[model samples]
Target: MAQYRWSYTSLQGKRYIVGLFHGPKTGHLMIYVNSKIVQIDFKVFEEKVYSFFLEEDLCEITIKKDNGSYGYDFQINKEVDTPLNRKRKAFNKVNRNRIITMFVGLGVFLAVIITFGISQKRKKEREKERYLQEMLAKKTVSATATIDSVKWSGDQASFYFKFYEGDIQRARIELIDKAAVDLYTQGLPVLKGDEFMMTYYTYNDSTSLKLNEPTNLQLANFMYRAFEQEQKSQSHLSEEELRCRVKCAFRVSGISGLADVYFQAETRESNPWHNRLTYNKLVRDIPFQEAFNEYCLPQ
Candidate 1:
C-alpha cells in the first residue's frame, strides 16, 4: 500500500472542507477526520484521486478498507502556510460596484430583518391579546353554560372533553418528559412494505393541533401505558425488554421509499401483534445520530 500527504490553507477566515479517498479494488476506503467517518463513494475509485481544500489547521485523516469496519490506517497533518500574494490578488479583484452592491445588499437584508422583527413582535402581541380575549369569553361562557365535561378513557390514555356550547371551540393537551428516544430498526423484504410509527404526538405548531385526527387512539393508550410502565417497572430493565416493550406498543401505520430494507418499532398499539414485530434483519443507520455520538457525546 502507498500513502500520501496533502496540504490546504485558506485566507477566507474559516470554513469546513471535506473530501473522499478511493483506491484499487481491495474493498473501499473510509475517510475519517478527527475520528469521524466521512463518505467517499467506493465506485468512484476508477478515477484514482479524491482530495479537497480546507482551512489552514491541523486535521486527522484515516483510511480504512470498506465493507469491513476494523481494517484501516490513520494519520494527522497540519496545513502549512504559503505566500499571501495570491490571496491578496484575489481579494483586490473586487471593484467599486461590487463593494457598493454588497453594502446595499447588506442594508436590504438588515431592513428586511428589522421589518420581520417588528412584524413578529406585532404578531405575538396580537396573539397574546387574542388569547386574553378568548379567556375572558370562556369565563363568561363557563359562568352561564354547563362546564365542559372531561372524560378520561383509561384504555385510550387520553382525556376527551366535550363542550356543550358553540361546538367546543377550544381544547389543549400536552405531554412533555425527559426520556431518551430508543430506536429499533429491522429490515423488511422489498416485496412487502416498510413501516414506521411513533408513540407520542408530534408537536410543531398551532396548525398541527388536530393531531388526534390521524393518531391511533388504541396505540396512544398502549404507548402511554407502556411509557408509564417503563418508568415505574424496573430501573435496570435489559435492552431486550425495553425493545420488546417498545415494539409491542408501536405498530406500522404505512410505508414508502424503495431502499435496502426498512422497519420501525416503537411503543404504540396501531399494528397487528406479530406482524408489527416482523423483521427482515437488515442494517439500520442514520448519519446525524452517529455524528452526534462521535463528535458531541461524552464518552
Candidate 2:
C-alpha cells in the first residue's frame, strides 16, 4: 500500500487534511475535517499520474508511480497569496450572496401567490351570500293554493300551484328548502292534492318564484302520523316490495307526484323509503271514503 497526504487552510485559518491511498487493486482519495473523515471516492490508474484538490482548490496533490519500483511519488501544491487567489475569493463571496438572494425572493413570491388565492376564495364566497340576500329581498306574493303536482330534478323541487288569475292559471315555485326536502326524505307527508297557504318571493323579474317561509306545509304533520301507523302495520313486507306496492297505490289515488319525491330521496347513505308508505296503506289501515279523507280523519 502507498499513501500520500496534503493539507490546506481556508481564509478563516480552518485546516483540512486530505489523503490518497493506493493498493494492488484499489485506490481512494479521502478528505478529513476536524480529524473526521468527510468525503472519499475510489480512483484507479496504471502508469499515469493523477491530481486532486482539497478545500475548493486551496491545495492540490499529485501522485505518480515510480519508474522501476512499486512505490509512488507525491507532490503538494499550496495556495499562495497571489492575484489569482484574491480574484477567486471575491468570486466565491459573490456567488454565495447571489444564492441567498435567490432563496429570499422565491420565498416572498410563494407567499404572495398563497395570499392571492385565499383572497379570491373569500371574495367569491361573499358575492354568493350577497346574491342570496338580494333574491330574498324581492317582493312577495302570498296565496292559498292546492298542490296540483310536485316534480323534483337534482336538488330543486318544483311545486305546481293552481290559483285563480282571471281564470285558473298554473304557477311553478322551485326551491331547495332544507325542511321540505328533509320531510320528504324521512317519509313524512308530502303528496299531490294537499292544500296549504304559502308566502313566496319572485326572481328574474317575476320569471321565477321560491318559497322562503314555513319550510314545510302545516298539514304534512297529519300525514306523517298516519304514515307511521301504516308502516308499523305493514312491517312484514320486504322494503323493495313495499316500495313498489306504495308506488302503485299513489298512481291509483291520482297523487303520482309523490313518486317523484320518492325517486329523489334515494341516496348513497340511506335506503329509499320515501315511496314505501302510500295513501293506499293509510286507507287500508284506516277506513276512509277517500284516501285524502284519511289524512283529515282523527288519528
Candidate 3:
C-alpha cells in the first residue's frame, strides 16, 4: 500500500489523486495517478524525480534525502518558491502558533483559579483553628467598675477604674494598647466619678494583665430619641405610670449592648449606666459630650 498521497485541482477544474509507493530495501519506486499506475522504476536508490501533466499544469514529485532518512515533496508548475506560496506557508505557520498559544493561555488561567481556591480554603481552616484555641484560653466574668480617673493623650484617653468582682477588688487602667488608640472612646464612655458594668477577660492560672472589655461600642442614639418620645407621649400619666413608661423606654433602648442600664433595686449600685457619659451626653455639647455633668443623675 502507498503511504503518501495528495489531491490537486487543475486550472480547468480537473481533479487528480497522486500517490507514491516506494520500497526502501527493494528500491522499487512507483507512482499512481487516479488509482492507475503512471510511472514505475525498479532499482531506484536515494533520490528521484517524477513529472506528469494534468491539463495545462506541470506537476513534479521529488523524493529527496532528509537527514539520515529520505522524504518526498510535490509541486505544480514550479510554484514552490513563488511569493504567493511562500506567503501561504508563513500564514499557515502563524495560525499553528496562535492555536498553540490559545491552549497554553487557557491552561494557565485554570491553574491560577485552582491556586486561589486552595489558598482561600487553607486560610479559612487556619482561622477556625485559631478561634478554637482562643475559646479554650479565654475566661469571661461580669464585673462593676467605677471611673476613678481620666487622662487624655493624643487621640486616645486612659481611664483608671476600680473593679469589684467576686473576691477581687483592683484599680485598673485600660484601653491603652499601642495597636488600638481609636477604640479608647468607644466602650468606656465615662468621666471621673462615673460607674458602669463590663466583662473582664482573663486567665484563671495567671494574675497578669488582661482585657477589661470590648472596645467596639456601637452607640445607638436612636434609643434616647425613642425614650424622649415616650416621655412626651406619657406626660399626662400619673407618677407611677410615668415611671413605668421610663422603664419601658429604658428596656427598649437597652436591646443593643446597653441592656443592664435600668434601675433595679438590688442591681442599682452595680448598674450605673444612667450616670455614664453615654446617657449624660444628651445634655452636653459636642467636644464636651463626655463631660462629668450627668443630667439624668441618679440620687
Quick one: best lDDT, which candidate?
A: 3
Worst 10 residues of 1 by lDDT: 178-187
Candidate-wise lDDT, in order:
0.37, 0.51, 0.57
lDDT of 2 by residue, 10-55 (tens): 6668776656556645655554444666556575445544444444
lDDT of 3 by residue, 109-205 (tens): 9899999999999999999999977785567566666668778777655768777657878787765553343233223244455545565666652
Q: C-alpha displacement of 29 in model 1, angstroms?
A: 41
Q: Check candidate 1 and list the clashing pairs.
A: 219-269, 249-267, 249-268, 250-268
lDDT score, candidate 2, position 298: 49
lDDT of 3: 0.57
lDDT tens string, model 1, 143-257? 1111122233432222222222345444433221112111111111211111122122113212111222222433343344344445344348664554343443232222111
lDDT for 218 (candidate 1): 34
Q: Could you give me the TM-score of model 3 versus the true structure?
A: 0.33
Of the pair 2 and 3, which is ahead by lDDT? 3
Top candidate (TM-score): 2
lDDT of 2: 0.51
- Once fitted onto the true fold, the runs of candidate 3 whose alpha carbons sit more than 4 angstroms away are 1-136, 139-158, 164-167, 175-237, 247-299
Task: Rank candidates by TM-score, best first.
Answer: 2, 3, 1
